[model samples]
Target chain A: MKLKAPECVFSSAGFCPGCGHGLASRLVGETAEELNIVEKLVTVVDVACCSFNIDYWNFDTIMAAHGRDIPTAVGVKHVRPGCPVLAYMGDGAAYSIGMAETIHAALRNDPVTVIVINNSVFGMTGGQMAPTTLPGERTATSPKGKDPARYGTLSGVELLKGMDIAYLARAELVGVGGMAKAKRYIKKALEHQLNGDGFSLVELLSPCPTNLNLPPVKAKQFVHEEMTKYFPLGEFIDKGGDK
Target chain B: MSKVKLNIARCKGCGYCVDECPKQAISFTGRISEKGYDTIQVDDEKCIACGSCYRVCPDSVFEILV
Candidate 1:
C-alpha cells in the first residue's frame, strides 16, 4: 500500500536538501495523524532549524525562544490541558541553551512530548560545535575537532535516563529499518502525552549534509556508523506498559 | 509490478533516494528540478517497490504505487 504523506505537513518544507529536520518534522506530523490528534496538537518549536516546523506544519504552532521550547510547551499544556503539546528543537537548543528548562520539565513531570534532533552541530548558525558534536568531529567553531577534555559531548537521552520521566528514547534515520523504528519511538512518545503521562522525550539522531560537508547519502551513513557509536539507539525508559 | 511516482516540483534533489534504493532503479536526471537541484528518475523495469526511496527522502518526493 502507498502510504499517504501526512496532511499536516506542507509540500514546501523550507529545509535544505538532505537536511534531517524535514524528515523529523514529517514523522511528528505522521504520528499526530495516526493518533487522530492533529487538530488538537499544539507544537512549540525552538528558534533554530526547528523553526522550520512552525511553517511546515499546518497545526497550531508557536515559535519559542531558542532553547525555551520545553517551558513554552509546558505552558501550553497548562493552558489547554486537553490538547497535546509537542516541543521540537535541535541539539543546541535542547542541550546547550535549553538544558535547564529540559531538565526541570522532566523533574517537574510535565505532560508534554519533546523531540530533540541531535545533529551534533548548530545547523542554523552554519554548523558550529554543539554539545552533541562527536569527539574529533570538525565543526565551524571547532576547527581542529571537538576536544573531549575541554568540551565533553552530552547525550540528551543519557542525561534524562536517570529522571523519572514517562518515556525516554533515542532514534536515528539511517535506513528504512531505522526510519521505521524512529517513527515507532516518536509515536510512543506522543502516546505518553495522550495518556496524560508526565514528560516524554525522543532524541532523534538526524543527518546534516550541508552542515556536515558531506553528500546527503554520506551524512546518513555517518549517523549510522559514527553517531550511533556515541549515542546508542533504543528505548532508554518506557513506562507506557505496551500499547 | 509496482511504481514510484515523483513530484519533481517539490524535489530538492538531495539524491538520498537515488543512493538508498536497494534495487538501484533510480538515477539522477541531468535536468534540474523547479527548485533548481538535480532531480532523479526511476527505471520502472528495475524497481521492486520496496519503498526505501519513500522512507529516506527528506522531501516527500516519492509515492509508491503498489
Candidate 2:
C-alpha cells in the first residue's frame, strides 16, 4: 500500500522559509486530519497563498471569491449539515472586505470553521496595508508606518469577541512549539463545529518576512512586536462553555 | 538520532521552516532558490522534529527520516 502525504503545497513539511502562513495552514490541515474532518470536510480558500495549496491539500477543497468565502462556506454547511466546512482566508480578505459576511455568519450561528491568517500585511497582493495592520505599522502602502488617525482602527480578535461566536481563539505561529500549540487550537475549533456549536475562528498572528523587508528571524521578532500587540494571545470566547 | 533535510532544487523559498524550527535553526543563504526568493536551510543539530516545519510548510521541503 502506498502511503499518502498530508495535504497542502509546501508538502516538504517545511514552510516558506520566511512565511508564517504555512504553519497556520498546516496546523489547520493536521488538526483537521487528527480530528477526522478530512473525509467529511471541504475547505473554502481565498486568494492568499493557501489558494495555491488548495490542489495539494489532502481534503476536498473549494475556492471562494476574494471576499465571499464565509457566505460560500455557510451555504455549504446549510446544504450538507454534517459536512465540516472551513473558510480559510487572509487578513485583508477576512477582516476588511469580507467583514460583513463573517459577521452575519456568526450572527446566524453558522457552523462553518473560519481561520483568518492575520499576518498584518495583505501578504499576497504586494503587502498593501490591511485593516488588521496594527496602527502605525509599515507596509507597502503604509511604508511610513500605519497612522491610526489617518487609517482608522485595526482589530480582528476584538471584533470577533463582540459577536455571538462560539469558540474564538488566537495563537501565534512564531516558532515550533508555538506553531504546534496553534495547530491544537485549530483542531479544537473543528471539533466545536463538528459538534454544531456555532461560529468558530482561529486568528493566527503569523510572520511575513518578505513583505516586512526583514530576515526570517527578525520577521519572527516583528510578529512578536506587531502582531501580538494587537491580536494578543489565548482564548477570547467559549460560548459552548465546555471548551 | 534522526534529522530533517531540505531540497534546494524543488524549494520555492517560502520560508515556512525558518520560523517553524523550535530551536530557531532554519535560515536563508540569501541566494535565490530555483523558484526564486532566498532559500531555506536548517541546522541539523538544532532541529527537534516537533514537525512544526512539516506542519506549516506550503513548499513541503522537510524530510524527517530516522
Error of 2 at A62 (Å): 1.5
TM-score of 1: 0.97
lDDT of 1 by residue, A129-173 (tens): 988999999999999999999989898888899999899999997
Query: For this target, which candidate reaches the highest lDDT against the unseen true structure?
Result: 1
Q: Residue A134 error for model 1, in Å? A: 0.9
Candidate 2, residue A102: Cα displacement in angstroms equals 1.0
Candidate 2 - CAPRI tier? acceptable
Candidate with top TM-score is: 1
Query: Model 1 - which docking category?
Result: medium
Instruction: Pick the DockQ winner.
Output: 1
Provide DockQ values for all models, in the order shown: 0.74, 0.33
For model 1, the superposed segments whose C-alpha errors exceed 4 Å read none
